[model samples]
Target: MEKLIKIISNRAVLIVLLILIQLGVLFAIVFRFQNYFVYFYTFYLLISSAVIIKIINSRSNPAYKIAWIIPIMLIPIFGTVIYLVFGRVRFSNKEKMKMAMVQERERMANESTVAKTTIDDGNPNAIIQSNYLSKHGEASLFEHTTSEYYPLGEEAFKAMIEDLEKAEKYIFMEYFIVHEGEMWDTILEIMVRKAKEGVDVRFIYDDFGCLFTLPHGYDKKLRDQGIKCCVFNQFIPVLSPIFNNRNHRKITVIDGKVAYTGGINLADEYINRIERFGHWKDNSIKVEGEAAWGFSLLFLSMWDFVNSTESNIEEFIPEYAPGELPENDGYYQPYVDSPFDRETVGMNVYLNLINRATEYVYFTTPYLVIDNLLMEALCNAAKGGVDVRIITPHIPDKWYVHAVTKSNYAQLIEAGVKIYEYTPGFIHSKTCVVDGLYATVGTVNLDYRSLFLHFECGVWMYKTNGVDAVLQDHMEIEKLSQQISLEQAKNVSFPKKVVRACLSVFAPLL
Candidate 1:
């Protein structure tokens, strides 16, 4: 009786009943409403048929194809309807081309500047330098930059504040998340002061990235303070379904010479002062030199897109030529990746490093939801006798996401890859060191979201001492992490495994 009542009370039943009643009324008025019914059914059938054809031809992953095939075969009409609205790629090709064109322009403008500084005075291994240029198309330029790797967020914050205080010409800051907290307050104060002093302060924050953290009209509030602000991809409540795409980049370029990038965000939690998760262990790198110009261009490109204004590239160029630092480091090539383009530059860079690893590959990411290509690359590396170790969070902030992360454990473990979970708190660092020769630090996570949905940036370094520092930090993190054995992973509860399996099916969508 309860089940019957529940079924009767369902909204679907009400909708169906309304449709039937409307049909009956239409039939009764057929003499007068003949054109209305004819046009309605005709348009419906035309849309349904078109949807079916699109579903039959749409591009998708193997898992998505198999999952969608069942529904497409079972219910042709409704399946086609759903696929047309949601199954197909959400972004338009025209928009993608526009993004690509913009990026190409920006790259072309910076290429000359990048090429002029290719001689590495620090003189890294010739082989490694050639490999980077060949594999990533990034010429290893002489980077006379002082890089300070902050192992914790507090140290990074202090450094960022100091750099912001020293801003003279312009301050271009971009981040994925900036919550209303002590960290943001401090930064906001600096931005306001800089704007007041006619310092040309500009900001670009991801809209979806800070959906709940920021209130409506926040951009206007910043503009009112004389600080130029642009929210990337304004969020709309009505378009809540398309929330997968986001700007997942954190960049700060001060005076087009000093820059900062890493996993750290402008939030108190990152500093460990407000412990929402655990210790909030994260890392950031501060760069000051010709390399900082690359980051400045990246920020200016996004700013141009948001503000719909042409960026004067020459205006941002430093008056004095970038001279080598007293203690110069090797080339630092900081590049960005956009989902708008088909090329997965950042992902390919990582895969190449993993494939070329002769000794060891160390990785730290908050999530480990990987696609087939990445999984096979890492597994093959491990099988070929490379020591592969990854550190993830033990206390996950998202239980479902954590389950999805662990679901791939069986395959990785069987392939000889070691896994560890940080016991103290969440490990939010997205970093990798391969053979102690190549190290990457940036906003790219080991997941589909970072790889295929969001805008991300990272610095690829070879022969820079920063690689050693990142490896040392990894070693220190290993002490705080607990290794997960194949035995333990295999014995996970059946119910939990079922949930993980279900979540894995939707990993791409997540």
Candidate 2:
């Protein structure tokens, strides 16, 4: 009874039930009016044609358009109605106004931190990529910054607590998941103490991501402890597609001088303290100096959005160095991506890295449901002998997603793109290292939702300790991962392969 009650009380279960009930009623109504079937059929055709046309014209992935088109063509009855409710990407008027405020504040913050970093004229590739992010993502490149890499979540947790312990002014954290466990408990203890000390401690977690992991009134508990807490896009029991827009970013900014980001979430499983998917593998970067300010601004942008309040963003900005600056630690540029933005910054960044790789490019992502453009880029890079490699999970968190991920492996392997699966367990790390010189570490996954629908963030680095650390971590992961050969991928059973292919069509939705 207790387990049943808990299952029914889950927000996801409730939302699913509500949507199913509404859909069932709609279907019943349509079936009841059988006498006007011809007219209904005509209306359905017209609506579906219009929706399909609109989807083709929208600024989205080709695979995504094809995915929707296939289903709409097959089930013309309910397809158009579904498309009308979920297909449109335009934000509601209220959401637009709020996002405008956040974007404008982000612009203000970006403007205040003009690019003071300079690169050698010989390193034109680095400068070009950095310029691209600066122009489109409103990010600044920093030169005099240092970075430390944690190849495992356990290492990052230790470093994070140390940083939190030393924070003098403020702390800001935004993450997709924040489950209650030994991990979050230890972090919360420090955060509560810091809040009582009058530090401006602020936290933001995605409501849907933590819906089952956290209690319904958990935000109030944090507030009672003097910590400012807000849930991003609080989950509502509705059938709107806007619920898909999740904040998938993981960020921590302390005193505006130290910051961290990567795949690790505030959950015990992430650190392998309480394993759910065997041994969990993840990575993170600890940055200091002016580069750290970039993450601070990123956090404040979302913070402003959640609180619906704007102040002098400059007041929260902290100088990485008050006196003399440290030695140059190469260039670092942090950027963000949102479904609201016209440009897909994360996708383009990956493309740029692949397109410009002179030697090799390696990446680690839990999911691999990519669009044609990224697939083409990887294949072309591999054909050009760029040594393209990718690491996906052996122990998947979602079976359907794993099936879809493996569906693309055959194509990639045939193109000479080497693929590996972490044999030990799941690897939730989202990282890419290119040419031993450039790398990125953050929450941007290789899937459609992370690339297109979600709000994500990542840090691009060139010739910095961050790049080396990420490269080293990837190499270590390679050692523990089992490589997938073209023959091995081709030997899958026909029935299983068919199911995987079918699942791939719905990859965007997954």
Per-candidate local distance difference test: 0.78, 0.87
What would you estimate as the lDDT of candidate 2?
0.87
Q: Per-residue lDDT tens digits of candidate 2, residues 1-510? A: 999998997777887798888878877887876569888788777878888888899877888888888878987677766766576566788877897888877877777665666678578888889989987775788877889999999999999999999988899999899988888999999999999998989999999899878878788999999999998988876667877789999999998888899999999998989978889998889888778888888888788887887856767777544664557888889899888877899999999999999899999999998988999999999999999999999999999999999999999998999999999999999998998899999899999899999999989999888888888888889999999998888889999989998998889888
**Clashing residue pairs in candidate 1 (N, C-alpha, C atoms within 3 angstroms):** none
Tens digit of per-residue lDDT, candidate 1, span 57-157: 75444555544555555663455444543455476666666666666667676765554555434534435544554334322344676577889999999
Worst 10 residues of 2 by lDDT: 317-326
